[model samples]
Every structure is written in structure tokens, then in C-alpha cells.
Target: MNKVKLLNISIDNISQAEFFEKCKSGVVFTPNVDHLMKLQSDPEFVNTYKDATYKLCDSKILFFISRFLGTPIKEKISGSDLFPAFYQYHKDNEDIKIFLLGARVGVALKAQEKINAQVGRTMIVGAHSPSFGFEKNEEECAKIIELINQSGATVLAVGVGAPKQENFISKYKDQFTNIKIFLAIGATIDFEAGNIKRAPKWISEIGMEWLYRLLAEPKRLWKRYLVHGPSFFWLILKQKLNFYVDPFNSDYSEPYKGVTREEMG
Candidate 1:
């Protein structure tokens, strides 16, 4: 498990199996609304992307979780639901060391305190709150790498939001050889730290998590859930119609089969 290269990301080439193999410790499988929107725009491109994503999710060595509003199925759980499971696993197995990175100013510290109080001597090695932005100074990047390496943590939970967090892990993966797992858990740190309230179980179970999120933070998420939500459904419909006539002989409609989109299409 030392320096295993599982992910292959090139400009013109990508493989899903490689990504899954790389998650021997653990990996994050995040699907933001924006990514789904991008997929809806181009089924071929998205199918390729999702193929790689789902392969990674299927890894047994890696803990799979998605940070999304509504999934295709009713019984699927959100990333928030899996956080406690991850915590409990670490609590039971003292060999796994965790490092918390990113979140609001004091959110990481608060989360560390909460987990420690609850778990009673959990195996959290260290925690830090990184500044929000893409361009990181040399000093900042060096500091983060040094902290992770010195902390001796195997799992690192990053909460700096999409693309940014993913890019950060890609940039620094080689620096922390001891780090086996890297999770880009968008806003889970805030929710776990009690900085934000999660939606009720009933609301989440019914796939109305988007509505609850909109009510909670309308200004920030209105464009994402409200505007983009219907747009996704519309794109789904269009793809369905295209599949029915076999215009291009594409298989985009099969992934969402037995669902409303399949019936309507």
C-alpha cells in the first residue's frame, strides 16, 4: 500500500478502474449539482466521466459517499449520513489516523473538539482551516503538506468545495505518502461541527433535501437547486426522447432505467 498509483488523469485519456484501484485506503466520490448539470448537457462526455466515478465508488477498500441533493434511487444515503459511519469505523479501529483540512475559520477545530468529546480519545491526528481560494501561496502549500506528513494521518478529510478540493488533493497527493485516504467532503465539516443544521431524516428520505437546503441558504443555492434542478429534469427528458428513436444509437437511457425518466422516455 505504499505509493500505489491508482488514478490516471490525462488531457485525452482516463480510466475508471485505475481510479478505483488507487483508493486502497479510501476516496471521496462527490457529485455536485454542477457536475450533474454538465453531464446533462452532454451524455457521451458525462457517461464517460460517470463511468470512471462509479468505478471508484465500487471499490471495497475505499469508502464511497456522494454529496448530492437527490439520487436516482430512494434508499441511497447522502454523504452526511456516511460521516458518522466513517467516524465510528475510525473509533473502533485505532490504527487509522485522521486529519481534517479546510472549513470556515474555526469549523475544523470545532469539529475536532466535537468528535473527541463524543468518541472519547479518537484517533484524529490533527486539524487545520485553510484559506478559501484557488491560488495557494508557496508557504501555505508547504505548511499544509508539512502538517499532514508530521501528523502521521492516513485519512484526510478536505472541505474546500468542489474542483478546488479535488485539485488540491491531486496537487498534494504525492507529498503525503503515509496518507492513504483523501475525502473532499464539501460542507460536511460545518454540518458535523454544528455550524449548520442538517435536514431532517424525513425530508432527506423523500429526496426533498434540495428544498430544505434552499430554505436554509436561498441566496447561495437558489441558482443551483431551483434554476438548475428543473434544467436537469428537462435534460433528462431530452436524452430520453433521443434514446427512444435510436437517433445516435447511444446508451444514455440505460443507467437510469426502471425510473420515471425511463418510463417517460
Candidate 2:
């Protein structure tokens, strides 16, 4: 897979189809500004991304910034977008069982119900909404891990929010003998369940989805959008101007450096 480094993180430069083709089993992290910013302080989060099967671009602002920095990412492959596509791809793939982990109480169940109703099949084998800080309790974590393992799910969609989802998987992934795919999809469970409405298509196309999200939950998202968001643009400027130490430096190795699916085919 071809990749480019943005903020010292390896971001896959692949089309949506290529993304689906390549994703098999392993952690997937979609790095937005918030995630990238947090990476500066979170070593575990950084390692999680480093070990991910797919480190996709999650934010349009980050995509624009990548272009402005002259190391363009090919596309955005957000978990919210991919979750629906997962169902679409696996609609007839009964063998590819899925599990939903980490939503508010009943959210994943509702999402599963909606998927079953609309898709006309039963793909989700299990859904769990762990209590807050359940990870802190060894007994609870063990029980949940065992439940997931027993579900025999091939894909696990985790929505407990960033580092938590990633950490949860990291801590117990080995126990998941049947699971192959895992997505650390923050709040996508809410979106999938219709608990939170998505923005209009036009808004998303114009890269104003962030604005819509900000307007949707200003109380919870203001600091992320209004405060930390500006710093991203500044970081871009710094990268563009070569104004900082090791400005825009990327040491990422793309093993499939010049390869593509079409060419391989």
C-alpha cells in the first residue's frame, strides 16, 4: 500500500475500493486533527496507529492540508463512511460475521437492528456496550473479551472513542481467535443507529462537514473545532514554509510504493 507521512503518521494513499480490497484483519485507525494532535502526547495511540492495517485519512481539512503541503493523500476513508460500505459489501457474505463493540447502552443493538431490517440479513453476531471505565476492571474486561470471542465474529466495529477503542483491542486482540477485522470507529455507532444525524451530502462534498458537526453538537465539539482546529492550519503553514525543526519530514516506507491493484491485475 502506498502511504505518505503527515505529522509523522503514515497515512495510506489509496482509493476507497483499494481500501476495501486491502483491509483484512487488524486494527484500523482514521487519523483526524484531534487524533493527530493527541498523538503528540499519547504514545500508546501513536503505536496503535503504527501497527494498524490501515491508517486512513479521516478529516477533509487534513486532506486539504496534505495537498497544501505537497504530499497529497488520495482520498478520505472515514469509519462512518466505511461502516455502511461494510454492510453493502458483505450483504450476501454470510461467512463474514460482524460484531459491534462500544456504544452507549442500546446504541449498537439499535444499529444492528436497523442493519438487519434494511439489509435483509443477520451479519452482526454480537453487540456490546461496555460500561464507562470497564477496562479498568480486569473481571469485566475478561468477561467482555470472552463474549466477543464466543460471538465468532470476523469483523469488530468498536465505537468507544479513540484511544479507548484502540487500547481495548490492543489489550485483548489475541483472545479474539475468530475476529479478523477491527475498526476503532468513534461515534460512528451513534451515526449508524440514527441517534445522531449525519450532515447533508452537499455539506460533506464541500468539506464543510466539520462545520455541520460543530453546529450539531457545539457544546461538546466547540473546543475541537473552534480552538484546536486553527492550530491545524498553523501546522500546515509551518510545514509549507519549512519553518520548524524537521518541517514536513516523512520517513514512511511504502512497500507497495508504485504498485496498484489495476497494475497487479
Candidate 3:
């Protein structure tokens, strides 16, 4: 696979076609610096989820921080940004079909309408909104898979938040071999459907996108930015200091006790 470097992070540079081909029966993580630091610090978590694969991507905040720290890191096109390319690809090739899974209320349909209008035509075959909680609805899940299969969708874009979306993809990839891509695009549909606003280019460039989001939905995001943001930074710093220590030398039995999968889900 082709690759690029920005700061110290190496990013894979696979085209949409190549990416779809590579993602068979495995989970792909769009990791930022914070995610990398967390994984490095907690090898047990990585080991526990060894079935999953990871790809480093440049979050805007991480990009700015890397520049400030004088580290080299290159930005890879994110899952959210894949829509335009995928839409064009679908137009050119009539064989491809896509499924949009998960979004708040009417956002998925709105996104479908918008994309269809923007592209003149679209490959979107089906869409759904799963419930918020972690409790599994096996019947509903099976119905979703059946619907995708019936619709002949070759790609699935899951809008569920991580790592639930990641978990779902990892769990269900085998059942849907006809599906070429399973992307866990966090909040992309909401932004596309006008339910949420993405930060302006300047704000994103300056790493204040989080601030913009916080300002927009303070009740929902305040804790994530104000609390988790600082903690993430501190964890990154600690990981940097521990670079000399052999990461894998530590006992694998010790798990990351701070947060449960439920909390993250």
C-alpha cells in the first residue's frame, strides 16, 4: 500500500477502489495521535481487539498539535470526505450500490436526497437509523442485513459512533461478503443533511473545530471536549515520555481500567 508521512505518523494512501478491496472481513480504525498514544499505552486493549486493523488519519486538532511539536505527520482523506469520490465512482460505474446505515431521525433520508441531487443520480440503495443504546436487537440487526442484501448494496456506510460502529463492522463483515466497503463515518451524514454544521475551513485549519462543535451543541459535547480533550493531551504527553520503555514488554494481562467499552460505545 502507498503511504505518506506528516509528523512522525505514517498514513496509508490507498484510493477508494483499493481501500474497498483491502477491507475484507476486518475492522479499520481511523486513528489520530490520541488514539495511537492510547493504543501504545494500553497494549492489552489492542491485543484483546486483535482482529481489528488500524489506519492513522489526521484529525485537524492532531495535525495542529503535530506541527506545534515539530513532528512530521501527513493527512489522509477521512471517511467523512469519501462521499464525493464514492458518489462519482458510483455514477461512472453502475454496478456499485451503497447502503447508508445510522443517523438521527430524518438525516439519512435527507443525506440520500442531497447526494442524489448533487450527483444527478446516486448509488444509495438503502438506509436506516439504529437505536442509541448498546443492547443488541438481533432481530433488527438481521433485518438490516437482509435489507442491504436485498438492495444489492456493495458498500455500507455506518454513521454510528465509534467504537460501536467499528464493533458492528467487525462482528458482521463476514455475513456481508458482497459488501465491498464498511465505513464507520462518525457524524458525516448529520453534517451532510444539514442537521449539524461542520466548522469553517479556517476554524478547522486552526484546530478550533472542536470549539465550534462545542458551541453548537454544548449540552452534548461539553464533556467530550472540556474533559476528555485535556485527558487525551496528557495521555499523549505521558506516552511520549515512555517511548524509551518497551511497549510490548509490559504484562498483557493488565487492561485499560479507565474506560469500559460500554462508555466508549
In candidate 1, which residue pairs get closer than 3 Å at backbone N, Cα or C atoms, i.e. clash? none
Please report, as a residue range, the 10-residue window in candidate 2 with the lowest summed lDDT.
Answer: 244-253
Residue 89 in model 3: lDDT = 57
Ranking by lDDT: 2, 3, 1
Off by over 4 Å in 1: 1-24, 38-75, 134-138, 242-265
Give all TM-scores, in the order shown: 0.69, 0.89, 0.76
Task: Give residue 36's lDDT in candidate 1 (0 to 100).
Answer: 52
How should the candidates be ordered by TM-score, best one leading? 2, 3, 1
Best by lDDT: 2
Q: What is candidate 3's lDDT per residue for 116-220, written digit by digit as tens? A: 777676677777777776328878888778778887888788877655676677777778857866666778888778888788878777667778978999998
Q: What do the candidate models score in CA lDDT, each in turn?
A: 0.58, 0.78, 0.63
lDDT of 1 by residue, 113-195 (tens): 88877777866778899876633676888888998899988888887765566667766677896887777677788888999
- Better model by lDDT: candidate 2 vs candidate 3: 2
Specify the highest-TM-score model's number.
2
Q: After superposition, how far is residue 128 of candidate 3 from its true place, in Å?
A: 1.1
